[model samples]
Target: MTNVQGMIETCVQCGECVEVCPFYKATGNPSYGAMAKVGAARSLFAGEGLTEEGLKTLWLCTRCDRCVSTCPVGISVPDIVQSARAELRRRGQWPQKCSNIANAIIEHGSPMAAPPQDRITYLGKDHNVREKAEYLYVPGCWASVRLPEVARASFQLLTKAGLDITTLGEKERCCGLFLIDNGLMDEARELAEKNTLLLESTSAKTVITECPGCYDVYKRVYPALFREPNYEVIYIADILKDIVEHGNIEVKHSGRKVIYKDPCPLARRYDMTKAAREVLGHVAEVVEFEEHGAEAVCCGAPAGVKPLYPEVANELAGKLLKEASSKGVDQVGVGCPFCMHHMSGVQNGTEGPLRIRTPSQLMLESLASER
Candidate 1:
């Protein structure tokens, strides 16, 4: 039996995962917690049938791994949950939107359904993509399709540092974190293989990304699934500390108060709170939100939760926006494009008190100050 199955069978049912789960805490539903969901999956694998609602509960998980730290048995609940999701998918039962996302990624090379040409639209018609460069920037789906400025700002920052950086233009595919999180392993693997081939064809020795989801998948998930990527995978936030310290990039003191919203994958999964904080400190006065770091609140729609449960996602977003407002900051610096997208949705609709800006955008402001 697999280690995950061993852990599941040996689980003491101590309810430790319940206390740390944000979705379970927010919805107050046992099905949303890791303990109940894993037990349900265990029963199904043991030849017991679950109701349709029981199956839906598995897809409801965000795969945050917050429960892993609290489990005395050291069970990786998220892995078990993903295994359950794959079983459900095999039975022709899965979230419709998630399935569509997988199809979109397979058909269009992106989950956003954007065309290949659109990926390079932000680069303008006159810009060129180098065939051989030292760095290759993969601007994931959100940044390349939905938020072009974030991609633009990231490109500008890297170029300003005198690095020989180039983007893949249309060849770069979605990093497939969305599929991996949803238990679409086969789809994720296929996409990752295609991306890996394209990535290796380039002369770049390093690949940089601004999206935390993409960064996490490349740095952590891909290596476990396939051979390590030929080039290094780096999060832009991780490089900012070195770039700023060496005088490669200049960030003027704005004297403005800004609080950083740590992306869940960065803080809880990868422990990147310090790196994100260092990047923010260079641009503005860093302030703390009420709940921060590992304990920070989940931004309502971290993965596909927004499409699966819009009301719940918005509720979490509203609550987080209120928390940011009380901090009395001029703006909130978000490292993840996923979080920034939803937070901006809340900000735009209600014209909320505090503004939401990407850390790269804030850095761009510092660069603009020179003019």
Candidate 2:
């Protein structure tokens, strides 16, 4: 059990967290507030248990850690909520959506519950997949299943730059971020060990991923759960930034103006807020959100919130789109595939007023224009 008593004892209940919590701001539910979540976590920690409502409150959190930044005492509400969720899992009281996704990842190696064979279909028959390489590109479940275009663009950009990159293809499994988010530590650890072994077998010294969730797990969570990875884990944005800056490939400037939406994991967790901007700046005129970088607002699709609370997720994503529209940009360029998926879903269509695209896709557009 993760002890959060120290965190709970430090809270002064100043309510700073409520002002920044997207869940609380969107739903206006006091129970969904960060302070109330700490209280629920306390109850669960003390073995008093939580009501169904309290459990729902815990799950409502996206773990964006905005509350942590606001708390004067530096109380991490996300950590407390994660601990509370572990208690719920122990009692078999976790929500059905969590259970379904967990089972899909464990049984089928993806949250989509699709067969492993479905993972490689997007690569096309003529795709070249090396058996061993120096860099392994992991598109993650979202890129592999939900948004293949992101994967295609990223892979194409890397190859165009003449880097030695290969993918796991059908042998890849979920990075187990959902398990960690939902407090299924044991299952998450199993996945960490499996993925680490598979990655080591490829003799790849670096693992490059297009998904922020995958990068977070491979770079941060996996090491903490077990040992540090032998290979370095990097985000595709960093690679794209290098490729654009070095002039390895000619890219014409795009006339489109874009607002960059920073993914929480890359911005707040990893302190990586510049790479995507540098890449996007080369191809398009990049704009900023009112709150960006470490303080950027979340897209509200992470963890199990989108699957469990669709309305709240939509409400949160809508906030970003409305803000982008006010900025009068041509589109929103996101560094994370999950953000692209959620924001694009809420935007409704590719030809919609507010467009959502990855940095790689935008760069690909620039490359095509030069041709």
For model 1, the superposed segments whose C-alpha errors exceed 4 Å read: none
User: Where is the poorest 10-residue window by lDDT in model 2?
Assistant: 347-356
Candidate 1, residue 61: lDDT: 69
Q: Give per-model TM-scores.
A: 0.94, 0.96
Task: Please report, in order, the local distance difference test score of every candidate based on alpha carbons.
Answer: 0.81, 0.86
| Candidate with best lDDT | 2
Candidate 1 worst ten-residue window by lDDT = 52-61
**lDDT tens digits by residue: candidate 2, 1-371:** 33488988788878888868888777888778888898888888788958877777898888887778788888889888888888788888878888999999999999989777777766878986788999999999988888888888888889889989899998999999888887888999999999999898888998999898899999989998988888999999998888877888777778889999998988888799999998888888999999899889889888899999988989988888988998889689998888888898988933458768998998898888887
What does candidate 1 score in Cα RMSD to the true structure?
A: 1.8
